[model samples]
Target: MKITVDRDACISSGICALDAPTLFDQDDEGVVLLRTDRPAAEDEQLARDAALACPASVITVTEVE
Candidate 1:
């Protein structure tokens, strides 16, 4: 899967980090930072959860063939 974060739409709620620390993080300014856009198979669920947990709905996960 491929993860994308809309920096302008991020509210800095940190939900993504809470749901998947390994895949997401916050920048010094508290913006969402993508640790890995291409997550491993094992982390797919967490990545999805993080995207859903985002209150701003800025996180997007796209299936990669």
Candidate 2:
């Protein structure tokens, strides 16, 4: 799966980081930083949850064939 974050739309709520710390993090300015756009199979669920937990709806999780 591929995770995509729209930095412009991020509200810095930190939900992504909280939901998937291994796959997401915050910058010094509190902006969402993607630790890995392409997550491993085991981490895909957490990545999706993080995407869903974003209040700003800026996180996107796409399934790659």
Candidate 3:
């Protein structure tokens, strides 16, 4: 799966990082950071859940293929 995040739309929420630490992270200023655009198959669900848990709704998860 592919994961994308809109930093401009992020609200410093750490939900993404908390939910999917391997796929997402927060900068020192709390902006959303993309750890990897393409996540492993095992992490697909984590990415999806992080997307759903994001309060700012900035995280987007999509199928790579």
Reference-based lDDT, each prediction: 0.91, 0.90, 0.89
Instruction: Compose the digit string of candidate 3's lDDT tens values, residues 1-65.
Output: 77888999999979888888999888999999998999888988999999888898998888868
Candidate 2 worst ten-residue window by lDDT? 47-56
Model 2 lDDT per residue over 8-58, tens place: 888999988988899999998899999999998999999888877789999
Best of the two (1, 3) by lDDT: 1
lDDT of 1 by residue, 12-45 (tens): 9998888899999999888999999999999999
User: What lDDT does candidate 3 reach at residue 62?
Assistant: 80
Better of 2 and 3 by lDDT: 2
Estimate the TM-score for candidate 3. Answer: 0.94
Q: Candidate 1, TM-score vs. the true structure? A: 0.94
- lDDT of candidate 3 at residue 36, scale 0 to 100: 92
Model 2 Cα shift for residue 30 (angstroms): 0.6
- Model 1 spans with C-alpha error above 4 angstroms: none
**lDDT of prediction 2:** 0.90
Using all chains and alpha carbons, the TM-scores for the candidates as numbered come to 0.94, 0.94, 0.94
Best by lDDT: 1
